[model samples]
Target chain A: MLSIRNLKVTVAGKQVLNGLNLDVKAGEVHAIMGPNGSGKSTLAQVLAGRDGYEVTAGTVTYQDRDLLALAPEERAREGVFLAFQYPVEIPGVNNVYLLKAGLNAIRKHRGEAEVDAFEFLTLVREKMQLMQMNESFLNRAVNEGFSGGEKKRNEILQMAILEPTLALLDETDSGLDIDALRVVSNGVNSLRRADRAIVMVTHYQRLLDYIQPDHVHVLTGGRIVMSGDKSLALELEKRGYDWVKEDSAAA
Target chain B: MSLSAINQPAAALDHYRALFASRNVPDDALGKLRRASLERFLAGGFPTQRDEAWKYTSLRRVESRRFAPADAMPIGADESQWIADAGHRLVLVNGRYMPTLSTPAPQPPGVTILTLAQWASHSPTQVADFLARHDHAAPHATPPTANGAFEHLNGAFSDDGVVIDIAPNVQFEQPIYLVHQWCMPASARSAGSHMANPRIIVRAGAHSECSIITHWVGDETAESLTNAWLTFDLGVGARVSHLNLQEEPSRSFHIETTRLQLATNAHFGKHDFALGSALGRSGTLVTLGGPGANVSLNGLFAPTGTQHLDTYVHIDHAAAHTTSQQDFRGIAAGRGRGIFNGKVVVQPGAQKIDARQSNRNLLLSNTAEIDSRPELEIYAHDVKCSHGATTGQLDPVSLFYLRSRGLGESEARALLIRAFAQSMLSTVQVGAVREWLEARVQRRFDLSAGEHS
Candidate 1:
């Protein structure tokens, strides 16, 4: 469902993602683990089409289409969702309002009818329940004054509503406590399907324990240094990234 | 600033003096008041940038025009659309009362709604008494008039407007809607610009409560000016809510001055919504006279094109335990310019006074401009007062977030701007008034195309 070849990205004249490569097929979950400054977040940002990241040389293909050429909003309409590491706090925009707009835009892009308020409300309420979000959360301004865990849960709620074909989760478990982490992982687990793909970028192996990944890749110096099964995350968790850094250096 | 050069508008001065002479005004106390006001206007011709109060706004556009007194033009049936939803309405055309267009409901026992001309001729003694009792020079706690030229101009050329009086302990269930329409015929525009000076006086007696919605409407193509003055006096323990809606066309100019005074334990709340007019200025002065008096002033102005809107507000916390709050918001798009200057004063010995003032502005375009100044003057030792002002564009992150969600760029902007302005519109406790304001806001923002989604 997604392919990237020699993804060389630079932000502010500094190479963030140098010659990084990744590939994922439908019905599979992939986890990219890296220490700080290993371009784990850069890869997610590049895939999501955020501005200010100059692609020195790369190609990202999604569903047989050139994803890098699309605008951020266009990518969103094409079923590409990015669960930000830090959800922005928008003071005046309502949470449910943004979700409805996102859903309707994707539906419209797919040549479907726009959902009416009543139908949209029902869909949102069910999704909110799946995320265990209170009804008042729908009326509150988007992420404004929300706790760290609450913000992470809202990102998951949006992902569930958008139902993107390719989802990029960037450190979704960073600020969550044990209880919130369980709830967020449950929301993400419910979104697993045979036709969808999720790529999670994280530092620790804690989230991998909940939403087990089919494949784990260790990134170092902006490149994928090692690729293995779920056991690789446990190995890295026990030994830390220094062993991987040494191995990459020796290679 | 040299005083002579600042006060030199001989042509405009001559025009107004000529109109005053033509009027058949009596030489009684009321007439002397008019003369005194005219002299004051002459002493301080038209406010210029040199004046601290009018620093950011220029009256050159108004001074350059040669405006004659507005005539009693005919009111078409279509013009009545402005007051169609009003249950008890008093309509004025070119500052003159239009009984035919008015739809005044049967009044309650102690409520009186009559035009200034009718009150002057029919009840001269009562008019004199009311004017004398609240004389400007009297030892009242209310602040003096703030807008010199406009207030004096309105008094000098004042033609006629509605006077609503509620007797003591009389609570009016229905609001009195005053619609002032200023429109010049196509031929009149050829002769010269037209101007109308309308004055309204409202008195809420002790323990009484009432509301009044004043609307200013004009022709979209007319090059006219409407100078309006309103004085609201709240008696002891009275409550009154005033909503002033200024919707003149872009080619028209509007100068409105409102003076509100509250007595012991009285409460006065005012909302000023201005969206139209090529050049508009709204000056409001609120005074909390007696202990426990409270005043709330909320204002919102959204101007596009080359429009210029200015708001000047001053609140006087004169009595102990009095409270006052002022919230003003402005959105300037295109080449529009918006100015807001709010001042709150806690007088000497006014202990326990609480005052708050804020002015928030949004600049939607590179060419748009906003100048906000919030001032606080506290003489009392035991008082709480705070003032602040902020001006900027929509948060870039917020805008991007909205766009990424599928709202068109314009739709996203409209939603955010509406939310910002809604902070003030929601303060309107009256449902009908709020609904009317919402429709007007939607129309102004060009959100009529299902942009609410």
Candidate 2:
């Protein structure tokens, strides 16, 4: 479903991602494990088409289309979603209002009818229940005055609502507690299907215990150094990343 | 001073002098007020930016035009049908009361509604007493001395207006709507632009409660000027809500000054909306005279396409336990300039006074400008007072958040602007008026797509 070949990226005159390559097929879940400052978030941001990131040399193809050429909103309309590490607090903008606009935009792009307010509210309420959020969450400002766990849950709720083709979960499990982690993992697992893909970027192996990935890749110094099954996550958690770094250096 | 600044509007003064002479009733009390007012206006002339209160607003548009007091022009009933829902409409065309155009409710025994001329003829002593108490104590009454220029001008040239009096303990459920319409004269050069100066006096006796909605509109094609002055007095334990809407033509000018006096436990709330006019200014001065009195001054202005709007507010906490709040917002686009100056004063011995002032502005274009200043003066100890002013573009993070949610850039911008406007507009207690103002705001932004709910 997505391909990245030799992705080289720079931000503010500093190189962040250097010659990183990854590929994922349809319905596959890939977990990119990396240490701090390894450009994991940068890869997620680049895929979602955020500004200020200069792609020095790379090619990202998604569903037979050049993804980097589209604007941020166009990429969203084309069914690309990014669950931010830190969700932005936008005061005065209603949560359900935004979800409706997003859903209608994607539906319009696919030549479908727009969802009316009543129907949209019904759809959002169901997702809200799945995310374990209260009804008042729909009326409050988007993420304003929300706690860390609440923000993470809001990101997952948005992902569930948009139903994107390729979902990039950037550190989604960093600040969540055990209960919130269960809820968010349940929400993501419910979205898994044959035609959809999810890429989870994390620093710890706790989230994999809930939502296991098909393939596990350890990212060190902006490049994928090792690939293994889910047991590698447990191995990294038990032994740490220094072994992989030393092994890659020796290779 | 510069030559242009020193050059007074001679034609305007001449026009006022002629009108005063034509209507001067010798040895009458109203004439006495007019004569003294004319002399005061002559002394001050037209205020320039040199005046500290009017530093950001200029009256060049008002001084350049030669305007005569508007005559009673023929207006068809269809012209005012849109304002039909307004209860007890008192229509004034060209500063002249049109009995045929007005629809007043049946007055109770203690409630009195009549034109200023009729009041002078019927109850001259009472009229003299009211005008005397306001005009003599005016300089020290509400705004001190800085805001007396326009009040003096309106007093000098006000030919006709409405007087509403509510007796003790009277509760008026329906609002009294005053519609001041200025139709263009046939000849702009010969007859000059219309200058409609209407005076409104609202007095609520002890324990009385009421609401008033004042609308100012002018011809869209003609050059006109509206210099209005309103005085409100709330007796002990009275409550009053006043909404002032200025919707003049884009090529015209509108300036208004409102003076308020709140007695012990009196509640005075005002909503000043300046949404139109080529050059518009609305100034409000509220005085909390007795202990436990409270006031709220909330206003908003949106100007685009070379329009200039200014809102000035001053609140005085003169007694202990009094509270005052001021919330003003401005939106400028396409070279539009908006100015907001708000000041709060907590006098000596006024303990436990609570005062808050907030002014937020949005500049939609690079050429648009906003000048906002919020000031506080506290001579009393043990008081709580705070003020804030912010002028900037929309938040980039918020914009990106909305755009990433599949809203187009313009749609996202409109949503944020609407939310900003709603903050001030939602304060209007009247549902119908709030809805009408919301529609007007939507039209002002040309936003046709988004749901306003």
Candidate 3:
């Protein structure tokens, strides 16, 4: 479902991702783990088509199409979603309005009719229950004055609503507490299907206990130095990332 | 820049003199007062950039045109733009009261509504006395420069407007909707240009409460000038809410001056929406006179194309325990230019005064410009006063966040702009007025976003 080859990316004249490669098939989850400034978030942002990230070399293909050629909205309409590490606090845009507009836009792009208002509301309410978000959040401004846990849950709620083909979760567990992490994990786990793929980037191996991944990769010096099964995540969490750097250097 | 430019002021003065002579006004006290005001206007002439208050705006376009007095010519006008179901409608065409168009609903007891023309005709001396009493500049306040010039001009040519009086302890349930519409005369093209000076006076007696919605609209093809003045005198513990919507044509010019005086424990709130005109200026001066007075001023100004809009707000806390808040937003697109100059003063010995002023601006195009200045002159030691001003374009992060949610680039931009404007729109308590403003603002920004993309 997704492929990246020699993806060298630079931001503000400094290289962040150099010679990175990854591949994933449908119905699978991948966990990318790294230390601070190891280009984990950079990879997620670059895949989301954010500005200021220049692709100096290589290609990214999604669903057999060159995804790097599409604009951010185009990428989103083509079933690509990025749950931002820091959900922006938009003070005047209502939370539910954003959800409806986004869902309708993607629907329109897919040549489908707009969602019915009553049906949309029912779907949102059911999803909101799963995420444990208050009903007042629907009318309030998007993430404005929201707590750290609420913001993360809100992002997961959006993911559940949009139901993208490929979901990128960047540091989604960074600021969440134990309860919120459980809720977010439950929301993510419920959406796992045979035709969907999710790539989660995190530093800790704690989230792996809730939503286990099929594969784990250690990113160091802007390259995927090691790849293995879920056991590698526990080993890295116990030992640290320096050993992987040394191992890759010796290789 | 040219020889004729130097003589422009003199020529403007001569034109006004000719106009004053052509009117053949009676030699009564009111006429004398008008003559004096005209003299004052001629002495001051048109304020230039040299004046501190007029630094960001220029009146050169207004000075270049020789405008004739507007005539009350009845023509077929489109009333579709007027707010429907608005209570007790009073329509004024070309600054003259149109009784035929106004609602004939009998006013409740203790509430009086009449036109300035009708009141003057019934008791000219009494009307002249009322103007004489309230027209003077407040003591210890900074004398108006450009605003003074326009006020004097309105005084000289003031013909008709609405006069509302609420007796003490009276609660006027329905709002008073005042509509100012313009229709071009058949001879307007041959007559060069026409101008209107309409005056609105409202006196809310002690313990009374009322809301007034004033709308200024005109024909899209009319190239007329509207110079209007509004005054509010709130008695002790009275509460008043004033909403002014300016929606003149792109080819017209509009200048409005509003003065508000609040007494002991009185509350005054004003919402100003400036969304039209080629060159428009709104000057508001609010004075908190007695103890425990409170005032809030909220405004939004959006200028597109080559339009220019300027807002000047001056607030004075003259008594103890008085509070004031001013929030203004400006959006400039295309080659438009906007200015916001707000000043707050805490008078000496006015202890326990609280005042805050905020002005934020947005520029959508490379050529668009916005100048925001928030000034505070605090004299009392036991006062909390603060002011802030910011001018910038839309936030790129917010833009990306919206677009990443599958919204188009233009759609994202328009949504963010509307969000920025929502803060000001939410302050309108009236449902109909708020909805109307929301629709207008959304349509405007949506079109601009389409044009830019």
Best by DockQ: 3
Instruction: List, residue by residue over A94-117, the lDDT tens digit for candidate 3.
Output: 999999999999999999999999
Which pairs clash (backbone N, Cα, C closer than 3 Å) in model 1? Answer: none
Order of candidates by lDDT, top first?
3, 1, 2
Candidate 1, residues B202-259: lDDT per residue as tens digits?
9999999999989888776578889988889999999998888998877899999888
Cα lDDT, model 3, residue A241: 92
Model 3 lDDT at residue B274: 96
Q: What is the lDDT of candidate 1?
A: 0.85
Q: List runs of model 3 lying over 4 Å from the truth.
A: B137-143, B185-187
What i-RMS does each candidate reach, in Å? 2.1, 1.4, 0.5
Best by lDDT: 3
Pull out the clashing pairs in model 2. none
Docking class of 2: medium
DockQ-best of 1 and 2: 2
For every prediction, compared with the true complex, DockQ reads 0.52, 0.65, 0.87
